[model samples]
Target: MAISFYKYQGTGNDFVMVDNRKLAFPASDESFIKRLCDRRIGIGADGLILLQDHADYDFEMVYFNADGRLGSMCGNGARCTVRFARALGVIEDVACFLAADGEHQASVERDLIQLKMNEVKGVEQIGEDYFLNTGSPHYIRFVDDVENLDVYEEGRAIRYNDRFKAEGTNVNFVQRLSDSEVFVRTYERGVEDETLSCGTGVTAAALVAGMLGMQSPIKVKTLGGNLEVAFEQVDEGFKSIYLIGPAKQVFTGSVSL
Candidate 1:
């Protein structure tokens, strides 16, 4: 069988997207997904996204890590998936879809996607760092120099630490450029490496920065590009959180399976 796929990227977090409305692709094929995500052998992407029909939403977003594991809600993947849904005519300027985390809303203005993310109840301060879940579990640590830090080595150490040994957590190293701006780098668990950008990771970083007295409309600079995170502080925690960034389609092709 030949499956047609689209490539999409949001701040360099690329994904191989599939229009699975007909349920053509067998999502249970883990090995096949892993092989397809292999950089040298098949279509290289940080992850794979399947846009499927939903009962009460524009579509259902099914995401998988490069290692072929079902992953949590990916902020970047959700943004890219919205763009993919639009390209397929499943949606127009606005979208309401169900993701692994929960239901989400988004609006597209050209290449920029503003996705409503999950609300954060609270953040656990572990020593000098903070841990939280913004659609995905993340450990955020501030750094002095984000550009020169060894993200892979340091992130791997914390990711595999005994505290998060059972279910690993994505790690984010953040450096503040200003009161309202920051530079961030992430080591995603599923990809198991340092990626150019991570939506949820940066969102967590921005929210943490805000909790620490940073202003709203936090500007986050990732290796791939720039993203903006805005939120409203509520009595319990935070609400009306949005992750805004660019999601661009790279190409389209068919691969034999």
Candidate 2:
């Protein structure tokens, strides 16, 4: 069978998108999904996203990592899915969708998407580094020179370390440029590599910045592009967190299954 798919990207983190509202795709085939995300002979993406029908929301976002395993909530994927929903006339400018992490709200304007993330109750301090979950688990480390760092090597070390090796964690190195700006690079767990950018990782970094006394609406610089994270600090947690960035459809094509 042949399946039609859409390619979308948000800050260089690309995904293969499928409109599976009618349940046409074989979502249970992990190896097939892995092959579809292969760089050499497949669609070549960091992940795959399925936009399916949801009774309670605009749509349901089903995400899988490049490795073909069911992944946790993906912020960038959710943003791109929101745009896809709009293109499919499933939603207008505003939308509410169901994801692995639960319900999320979003607004789309042209190519820019503003996605609301879940509230974080607390941040755990592991030595000098910080760990938090912004719809996904992330380890945030403050660094001096982020641009010159070997993200792959260092991030791999931390990700595979004794403490986090079992259930992998996304690693992020953050360099604060100013009180309101930061540069971040991430090693995502599912992809198991240093991606151009990571939405959940960026959100984790921004919330850590808030904990360090930086204000809200932090500007984030990544290898792919720029993104913004805005939030309101509440009692011992954060609320109204939004990850703002651009998600664009690259192309559409049909592939044999």
Q: After superposition, how far is residue 249 of candidate 2 from its true place, in Å?
A: 0.4
lDDT of 2 by residue, 1-257 (tens): 99999999999999999999989999999999999999998999999999999899889999999999999999889889998999999999999989999999999877689999999999999999999999889999999999999999999999999999999999999999998999999999989999999999999999999989999999999999999999999988999999999999999999898
CA lDDT, candidate 1, residue 149: 99
| Clash pairs, model 1 backbone | none
With a 3 Å backbone cut-off (N, CA, C), the pairs that clash in candidate 2 are none
Model 1 segments more than 4 A misplaced: none
Q: Candidate 1 lDDT, tens digit per residue, 190-211?
A: 8899999999999999999999
Model 2 residue runs over 4 Å out of place are none
Model 2, 64: alpha-carbon shift in Å?
Answer: 0.1
